[model samples]
Target: MSTAEAVPKMHKACVYDQPGTCSIAIRDVPTPKPGPNEVLIKLTHSGICHSDYAIMMNTWRQLPVPTQTGQIGGHEGLGHIVKLGEGSEKLGVKIGDRVGVKWVASACLACPPCTESLEGYCFNQKVSGYYTPGTFQEYVIGPANYVTPVPESLSGEVGAPMLCAGLTTWYVSKPTVPVLGAGLGRMIYRLPELTVTAVCELLIQNMINIICVILEYSALLKCGASPGQWVVISGAGGGLGTTAVSLAARGMGYRVIGIDMPGKKQDVLDSGAEHFIDVTQFDDATIGKEVKRLTGLGAKAVIVCANSNKAYGQAVSMLRFGGSLVCVGMPEGEQVSIANAYPSSMIMAGHNIVVSAVGNRREAIDVMEMAARGVVKFPVRTVSMSELQSVFEEMSQAKVTGRVVIDFSAA
Candidate 1:
């Protein structure tokens, strides 16, 4: 194994001491050696995501099982590689290189989804915080190939949230080309007189089309929105919401309307939303009407980034004809279908509903590039590892404005 610094026998980790509740305890744990094709990272900053809280409290019913006691709970981690196991150098990573671990710690690259570039949905995926040891520790191990490379110019604090929140939002906002194989085949069959050069051009286009499609499941394309079209972001003040708002507005040229509680109004607006609606001031019906009022027609897309069932219930109503509702948030407890999405009404309006999870590896790199270029920025506050429990408490009460990152350097 290649090592850059003296290895430690133990490291400090924050764990969910009591599962099914908002509680945590920091303790000294034995540091683990990286196995084959893995690298040990000395985490510097780990962002606290709402999903981490859900795992700790066992609130997400869709998960196969509840979080276990003593499980380290964090996913958005940024750090430098301290040690590399055997054959890790073949993966193009080395000790002292900065990398970020995301929600999916690792995936069986042989799985069908992984082969299709959907590593997030791999059948044999290891989630970072649920059962596997996550990033809320001084040292963690990640697959050498899967860990994202951190840009030289981006700091660990800024790069941490991009692993999850920024990546998720950027995956949907980026444009992708439609698959063109079938179209190319039909053109070739119909126009046999086409020259060899023309056919080669078509094949090249098809290849680029497939590759781009695999890279991103473009939510804006699914919403049928063009640049300058209006889009609504529900829960636009939280970590994921704010990032989505900035990427959609400043990065993609969309006219954004952010919806959140009154406490988040300024943050939402500052994140680049053209308008902000306080959820406390308007009922569901009135809020939908207000969206229509501001948009002339309704919004071209409504992205629900809040973990409220009510946000999903009101999303479809805020869309124009043939518009789309992109569901990104996972509400706690029981799962409920989107209200007001009657089959007849949906059919009459030709509205579409799309669901997006964490993005593929290519999308992650793309979003990090965007972050490095200053196309998207996250408002973050750094907290010590000991404060994880308090941060979860604040998260449960909807008190966190942007993102809270746990600094492992203090350990």
Candidate 2:
């Protein structure tokens, strides 16, 4: 029988409602047929990234737009193309090929952000897990041109996390550091036969942490950060925070201070942070002093990941003379602006602040190869899709220590 004929009319999907609450229901939604330029993918695995948690709990202050109710909420999916709609074949991707989707569902190419090569901020951006139906279903639909092709050597669970979490850490915010396949123009490389063991090396090169290390390297370079300079990562025990810790310490040769709750100390140490500061032990006034004492002059740069007003307040104080504060988290209902910064405070501080979200598609390719090379490894845990609710609960409680990937074989 033909692939289309064998396709099921109904597929299982995880549906959620009322974004603030983690409300989820597993139901059999009718499978959607591929539309023109779309491809039907039977997903076997998807990663449970913190972005998913942020959406589920309605934590982000700004989404590209508000999420729709009953939208299937997942993006880091790995699967095979089962059927293609009209004109999709022209994209050069074939049926039965493995592919992955990122947080961006689709963007209006005519938007100013797209015109300026910043599709991440496209004015009409449709988020995969928010505005549109995401990859939380057994069968998901994706644009043939936008879906990233999965290499043969990378497994579902292993490659799945790279789609969102890894990409966000390495690519989105860090654009200056060029890695493999960067200069090749048309970052979407022609799919190499999945025959080789060196995964990202073919179209993109290197192994895990490519994007993370390179981006950190770029950020440090941009800030005139030299080796042996002190860099503080406020959420050092969290996902992207841990990555920053690792890249700053191990990759960039920077002395790293990790600031988080007392419980995350060991996790910070494991991630290559030189020192861990227990934020709970110190009041806001004293926390910056401790960091200053530890670094002898405070950190050269402070990357804030804790989604709180206090963290942002402390981040400004945690900097040394001319130090920069980079905010990486968005806490809903919290004040993050340096609006309180008068000219005197900012002038006396001599510090700068910057914000970055996700990276370009080209960077994603570079990092995947590093992962396939088995070099940059993030701590990962596997869970069934049914456990998603519980997982989010643990995350909300600050209980999860590593990246969570869903083994959707049972989904």
User: For candidate 1, what is the lDDT?
Assistant: 0.86
Q: Identify the runs in model 2 with alpha carbons over 4 angstroms from their true place.
A: 1-6, 59-66, 172-175, 180-228, 250-253, 334-342
Error of 1 at 168 (Å): 1.0
- Runs off by more than 4 Å, candidate 1: 1-3, 177-223
Best by TM-score: 1
All models: lDDT?
Answer: 0.86, 0.72
lDDT of 1 by residue, 155-228 (tens): 77778999999888876666654312134434445467878788777767677665665676652354466667
lDDT of 2 by residue, 1-411 (tens): 124436898988887866778777888999998999999888888887667878877667665455567878998888888999999999877788888887886666687877765667778767788878888878888888778777768867768877766666554223354432233212234346444544445435432335555545342354335567888888777766766666556544568899887877887898788789988899877988899889888888788776667788888777888887776666765345653445688788787876666555565675566557554445667878788889888878877765677777863
Error of 2 at 331 (Å): 0.2
Clashes per candidate (backbone, < 3 Å)? 0, 12
- RMSD of model 2, in Å? 7.6
TM-score of 2: 0.81
